[model samples]
Target chain A: MDEGSAALVAAGLGKRYRRGWALRGCAVAVPRGRIAALVGPNGAGKSTLMALATGLLRPTEGTVAVRGKPGFLAQGKPLYQGFTVEEVLHAGRALNPDWDDAYARRLVAEAEVPLGARIRTLSGGQRTRVALAVALGRRPEVLLLDEPLADLDPLARQEVMGALLAEVAEQGTTVLLSSHVIADLDGICDHLLLLSGGRVQLAGDVEELLAEHRLLIGPRELDVPAAAVVERRETGRQSTVLVRGLEPPDDAQAHEPTLEELALGYLRAGRTSGREVAA
Target chain B: MTWVAWRQQRLLTLVSLALVALVGAGMAALWADLSSVLPADPAVLDERYGDLLGYVPFVMLAMPVLLGMFAGAPVFAREFEQGTHVFGLTQSIGRTRWWATKLLVAGLPVTVAMALLGLLNAKALGPLSSILTSRLQTPMFESQGYVLGAYTAVAFALGATAGLVVRSTLGAMAITLAGYVGVLAAVANLGRPHYAGTEYSASGAVEPGAWRVEIGYLDAQGATTTFAGQKCGETPIAQCLLDQGVAGRFARYHPVSQFWEFQGAESGIVVLVVGVLVAVSAWAVRRVH
Candidate 1:
């Protein structure tokens, strides 16, 4: 990847806690204007990575950089509990020199979140919208959201993602979004950065990543090249295999896997192999 | 940033000001009545304001601690507790500025008000000074003069700094209360009287409200000595004193006239504490991430 065009870059990035490393030797670069999804299981260091990118956390080793000012929507989308939606927006304007009040107001108005309603009084979905508005109000060059849809209902998640998509369309801002659940990111993210345990298992353009991998299904006796297999499962009479690289063995039926399967395959593979990002 | 800080701190600020206002109103009434009866006779002054004289200083002294706990302890603690620091710290405004702005915006108003209250208290408790409590002593000294505000600032600084370390409002509050009282006790009982030069009076009849740091006999050689009650026994004090062969009576005292000097001295110490706390807090803000 060209470092110059990358909106977010992490080189040998690591974060250590008392018990163990939350993330280590993780290197990733998402190009500008791309919606990158950071997929990982719980405790996979997705939050740690986002926190580091936004400078809310300092890395224990190596470096993470955002090319320009970053707007972060942390888990739970923390807003001042006592502040009204209006007051929160006012705070956004006060804190950010580039804050777009008109854009924020329009977003809230579109969501029908009452400006006078205190944040603690808002519903889960409404809070998410207000949070998104605050994040967007900064008119950030890059937006990093950690588990933005964790608490929202399906419809609300759709609405939230829709709003985010609109922001990206209008502003062309680079967004790096993280979620443990891959289904939530389906069709929305153009780039995928998959982490497991404390390492990045996969990082590349989603379309190209999916194209490079194939799933094989056949009898359990079929011999599969171990080097090509990213992840595999066998149950008596049938064997299912997710393999990387363009060529597939002629003995077994091969087909393209869904993005969910692609992500889950790497995730499961990373867990078992304990893969490190660089080596 | 100032606007955000003020809005976030608005509720605490209003509540603290209202508390000061309530205490101020009550003190104002007490002043009105006590001013009329004071200097007549100590007994008369006591009779008019005796009820308040017993407990008012206690309440007055507790105000700074209360301000520190309620206003200052939660300044950082609430943000961390509620996970809102992520929002504030990640803003375009630098974290140190955010920390400083909140400290000044939330802390300054209450501190200034408490100082003004201290002045009002000095006035109200003036004529009745030494009738019940010495204005130069511990609980009273802390509550009565310009140092009241200074003490509040120190308490606030203690709370704010502890909050940054402890990251919990309740824990910081407890720490502030206990730590504040401990510091105040050590300063008042052990350190304060020595700040201003104490005078050795040849006679024990020092001015009323003069804080007696040491009272005893002065030998011919002028060496100050303690009043050992052992020599007096249970006999009448005059006979006990006569039997003791006491020489010239002398007292090492901080005179009531030194009220301003002591206030300035103690206030300066408290302000120094505030300065250290602010600097430490600035350094602490950087380590938060």
Candidate 2:
């Protein structure tokens, strides 16, 4: 509720369903004007964390605060079937006291969401776009999107992501978007929070994550620093080692991993070790 | 609107209003007796129209329940089920604000509409009751009166509250309707008019021969004739009397001829209880998740 604080802050956040912890002891802080990606595998609690952060779900323990107004782009687009896009948008305008009509119109125009089209009649992707457009129109302080780019055609994804980045740039709006597609987060998000098994294994700047983690490929018997190996893949002649927080040994030939390779290594480690990885 | 509210449920609002109007018209037609065979005769039709007017109050009851089940239940539950509730929660509006907006948007309009319809329908149905039967003209049970208005408001609030608590359209509807019927039935059976004390006392208690008695008969023309009597408790049949200084033999009866008294008391009680239910629903929505 503190308006002057960071855009988002979570302390020891946890969500325990009847079955088990969907997300536990997760914490994240995102400042204003930055895009943060919640990157995780299926059932990794990315969506759960997003839900908790947005205040859709109460944390079993911990706190999530959005410094100011936030906009949520829900996983699935839901609009009144009988209402046209314009009507639905108008309803938002009526209901939301902070609604920015100009931004809404601009997003609507950019997304090409037909104003007269009934929401139900629009295609799935189009409906998703419309939902996003409405959220953007709100001129929110923080926009939390859950799988907004899922099932989008390449071009559609570009358009939506473009709009999202534009909002972040123009309004200095902080954004937290979840996606399984690493490529989608490549250039758009400056930060990444990788969750596995109901916890955050790693969260930091994309550049820092890339610089600290290394993927070393060499002979199976090649001398390698055991401590640097966060994860390792082995075959008869080739070995791939994912080194965590690597300081790059003085005459070492170890190559730092790309975000994708590092992510894959973390995923492989989670699969093989059966570890909770939250640490 | 705080939290992330949707304007999509306006469909339910429009649909509920239209359906209520149709049902009201149908009830008016069914209960509007235009013939002598109906009751008390068309010459005494004023009261018959009054009987027909009884249905007007039900509009308030039906509309609120309908809104509760259809509007409140789906407001937030559907988003969770569809995996899209996060869209609203992450917005500039906080979760509580979103919930407040949704309730205001969906509940107030429907309640206002019901109130207006109740007034208009009562006016239209007034004449119909008089033309149907003369006996139905009791002042206590007048259609669309303050008593009935209170009942309608409470009923609607209760229904909406149920929707918020239950969080599923079908679930809220089933529970609300069942609760409505059960509460009314229970209150009626528990609070019916009945004798609470003995009808007679002894000589010392009676203070020597002090007695007061009266007899009344309702004529076929619906007028009452009264006779004072010194013969108190003289006959167990056709008359009743009691001594002044002691507990006397007296008859007990309900003030209104039919069960109108019971209905009024029970309706008020039900409304009060339902009002509480609505308040709880609002609170539940405020903390929705």
Candidate 3:
């Protein structure tokens, strides 16, 4: 495997269904060993891209390349309902030729999931842990996790992310996980890809992306360059505009936008564009 | 991949085989006890076995559909319903290997068991040939030979294909049952008779176990008699036949001795259907979301 190569690269990726395209012209690359977040609203092609990258679904018009074998924790963390946790791990071992049994066992042990318990018997948190263990068992160079924290409570979500981060840190594996909520991933993900309307709306180093955008507070009737504003909101007293890669105008007070504000701005921008296309 | 697929279907496959084994045990006992009542004619058969004659073949006929619905319908359908196919297909294995291994692992045991079961049923019912009508005939033919196994394979394939297409276990099972019955009806009525050339007999003494395809009188000129001519519906039909100058009753039939030939032919047709189903399923698996 090429250690310096991007963990995953998609070029002009497009996926079509019976009625319409789910994803189109998608292109992004996450550098090796980065914790990348795929942020989007529901039905923004986040899951579609994840599915394509993991090879579960093929692209209708492009290609996805993974530097090495990828391990996927699919949406809902689907373990065979009838299988015990041990059997699920056994299935992981059987399916993956390069399975790391020790790592798989340690993950389950650390999470306190009982080996003999059926998958359906486990609660949401426990099931997520077991599913993650199965994916990690393959010792893949890149791990694609789709909605790993969707069903967990806030505390459980923190714990699951903590566990996931701890493992990825130790192994130095690249990971790309998808989520609709920005607050959950605001701190953990250093690389970000925001998707909407089957395209990449924003993608880059999270810190860099944040630093490039500023929230400008100006008068409600203030005039500004349309090209400079990523998104805007107006009130009777004031207008708040998200400006990208620019200084505030002469009369406005500029403030650094929080990661959530930045992400929300981009997500809304993408959705508006998507609706325009649909209309 | 094979192990994973086998594990998924293990319990159902074993249970289905156990059901076949149970049937085999009873049939074996029947075969063992069959010699005591042999060499008798049909008149004494009713006094001997009575309604038991009807019960055995009915069970035999139902086995393939039962096994097909139980074993085949849920293979892919349940995976999709539970969302486990996402896990299965995303593994390092190619979709084709996953689909093919599943088909083979899930299908092999029941097919071999049904074939063996059919052999047992045939052997068990052989001595009662006078009472069984003919192994080469309808309903009886389906129960007694290798075609039974082939029917099972076709039914199983139908079920498995339906699962992939419908993506629902209950839907697949319903399709399997309906498709199995439909295929059997179509083959018995339309496909079986064309397997080989039928033998023509000059007398009404067509051999027992031979399937009677058609029968008509042949006149002195050796032309087949038509219904529009001198009616045989008259009283004293023997005298009426003489008055009409009918020389013989010509019969077209599949002989009892052609049992293996018919088995090979019918089984081949159904197995071809099985092949098509498998190929379609293999293609459909890749297309599933």
Candidate 4:
């Protein structure tokens, strides 16, 4: 377990529920000081995989390792109901040998978490903030957060995201946060693990995903390269095509797509044709 | 970190202390009224004081059950119910450490409450032993049954285990109460030798008929009344005695009384039994996805 090289590593992770596999044979490698965003639709196992990686739930099969104590923020900000805000922070200090009490207090004070107030008395956003403070106080080498900004209001979302971004910048902690809120991940994450139907539909550096997968829009009458086209949506006069591999035929007069478009294309390709990422 | 755990459980500590206060106040008033109202003839007061002392133990039996339900049941149950355990399990502590800390933190206030009450009772009733020679002539200020101290620890541990298993505050509560009642009832009436199996006789054969414990109750008139029942409704061997005929009135004469009852072998067994349950509970919680 080299401190710099292996922030977190998962080999062939899987989780099976009574209904079916929530996550099936998943593998991921997170490097130190990098931010990875696990993006998937409602039931794509983003949270499940994060939980397994953090050791909150034992994998049905596979191995996961963290170089040091991993800080984990679950899918929802779960907290003791009757404890005062200060008391909740104390729990973090008591449990984590590497706790930074000053840092925890700073975050709480900045977030305006009333130290005397009970957790049950705090608003939902306030509770989430306190939870974030607790997680950050650990000064962990690896941080795993599931849906960190799922329920936050737009204003609070930015504030929370900014706080996280600041911590990552200062401490260089490897962070893996999952979100259906794609925009939240756009600027913060360097890596992406896009999943669907219990498998990784596409996963790699965000730059690689944008570079390799091209979304094309052109005339329906024009010749579309069969191999380049992975999925397409046609609407009478114009057509939108999602292409994988080399540049969308230089010969075809089509406009390149945005990251959102490429993501949608990857998902649409998986839905229509059973195309799955090799990794 | 230990401080944090103690702080988290401060409310329970306060509640336990409040209970001690109430018991203290109530005992003080009862003693003053008893000594002042009874005839100056020490003999007359002696004749009635023992039964009044009996109430102390009788009422105190419910303390363990109460503490077990309120404090122990919520130790882990509320965490699961609120999903807070996810934070606890993922933190730096091992599952064992987490539970051990909770038991320690939660046990403090209960011990303090019991100890303080014990001291007060001793101060108030120790002097009466010489004058109240009749077993039934103890003072109204007598200490409650010592078994309550052991029972409270056991019940609290058992309730915490139930809390971990049930994962819901209300559900844990219901299960804990039912378990306490069931175990106590089984111990009192069933006459079985063990929790899970029948005890074998020296003959190496299963015993024949169900064993019964007959309890004789002496009413205010001083006549004895008896009731008979199977020890545990199990195979024939007599089980642990839960309570005697007059709601444990004979505890003063019971062998456990000669020594400090709370420090007896039964106490050790209670602690061990609940401890095993708590360990199993931690393992079970780990398996919960």
**A-chain TM-score per prediction?**
0.96, 0.91, 0.95, 0.90
Report the number of the highest-lDDT candidate. Answer: 1
DockQ of each: 0.82, 0.31, 0.74, 0.63
Off by over 4 Å in 3: A1-4, B228-236, B242-247
Q: Which window of ten consecutive residues has the lowest lDDT sum in model 2 chain B?
A: B206-215
Say which docking band candidate 1 falls in: high
The model with the greater DockQ, 1 or 3, is: 1
Per-residue CA lDDT of model 1 for A41-66, tens digit only, reads 89888998998998888999999999
lDDT tens per residue, model 2, A246-276: 6654434588677777776776676533344
In the range B1-289, model 2's lDDT, one tens digit per residue, is 4212334565677787787577657644544544333435545554444454455444544555555556555665565555444445554556566666766676666656655554554545433433332212332233333334444445445555655566565666677667655654555345432312222332213211112122234333434433345555555433432232222233322322333443466546756776677568667865665
RMSD of each: 2.3, 8.7, 2.3, 9.9
Worst 10-residue lDDT window, candidate 2 chain A? A270-279
lDDT of 1: 0.88
Q: Runs in model 1 with CA error above 4 Å?
A: A275-279, B218-244
lDDT of 4 by residue, A197-251 (tens): 6777777778776777766667776566687776878899877777777465554
For B113-159, candidate 3 gives per-residue lDDT tens digits of 99988888888775565565676666778887778899889988988
Chain B TM, cand. 1 = 0.92
Candidate 3 local lDDT, A1-279, one digit each (tens):
232578899988899887688788888889999999998888888898988887778899989888887999999999898888888988988888888999999999999998999999998999999999989988888999999999999989998999999999999999999998889998899999988877788888888888899999989976778998999898888999998988778889998888789988887777778765323
Candidate 1 chain A weakest lDDT stretch, 10 residues: A270-279
Instruction: State which candidate, 2 or 3, has the greater DockQ.
Output: 3
Candidate 3 CAPRI-style tier: medium
